[model samples]
Target: MMKQLKTLLIAATLLFSTSQVIAQAKIAHVDTNEIMSKMPAMMEAQKQLDNLQKTYDKEFKTMVDEYQSKLEKYNREAETVTEQLNTERAKEVQDMEKRIQDYRQTAQKELNQKEEDLMKPLMDRAKAAIEKVGKAKGYQYVINSTGLLLADGPDLTTDVKKELGF
Candidate 1:
């Protein structure tokens, strides 16, 4: 009698689970990368960043070139002078090299900060858009590419993109 009761309980649980699975829950996926690509503001920001990066590159190259020229000229002069001059000049060159390295590192950090500063507003806009889109469309849950990979589960990304154009 106990075995029969347990079997009935298990059967009822399975039926309830199946019903829940078949419930009317709207689910969709949104590809964030697609939205970012389509956003004109984001594109413009990227172009600005590209130009800034090029300028930074040129500045760094000019600095290195100037240093190299000075080092070359010093070597030539040292070849014609005493060992004492060579030692002093070598120390000077090493100090200059260290300063250049520090400058390069600082410049890179500033560039990264600049990118974040430029992009923060755009990112916030995209996030707000996601919530706005989700609420308006009656989606119980909107999933992203990141979600699918993180869960290692089925993807509804295409359906969401088709429905939302995002």
Candidate 2:
């Protein structure tokens, strides 16, 4: 009977300690997407990216038009031109096509790099604000509630936005 009583006392102590630990672990959630959308710096970065995209589109269209014009000209002259000349024209067209493809790939890479370069800092800033607010509020964990189906914890979105000065 004494051994059983001691075991019961130990189990109660462990349960009480576990409950205290659980109560001390404060958690919160924030919507990073909302904060990013409301941020003026993010919007400005998006506008810059859009302008760069437009420039690339215009240049790509010009290259496509030039390629089509050359192709049509070559096709029209294929019958009148010597076989060797026609072959040379075909090779020239192939070279132009390769160049256009290379330009498109390079432009896409540049745009991706530019977007990373421009947005990384803004993202970092938002993350830091979230972290700062979470820490200041004594939260042990701060989850991003962007895609969360259920977030019943305290929301830190407004606090993070205020921290970011937006």
What C-alpha lDDT values do all the predictions have?
A: 0.76, 0.94
TM-scores, all candidates, are 0.72, 0.85
Model 2, range 1-166, lDDT digits (tens) per residue?
9999999999999999999997889989999899998999999999999999999999999999998999999999999999999999899889989988998999999999999999899999999999999999999999999878999999999999999997
Candidate 1, residue 71: CA error in Å?
A: 1.9
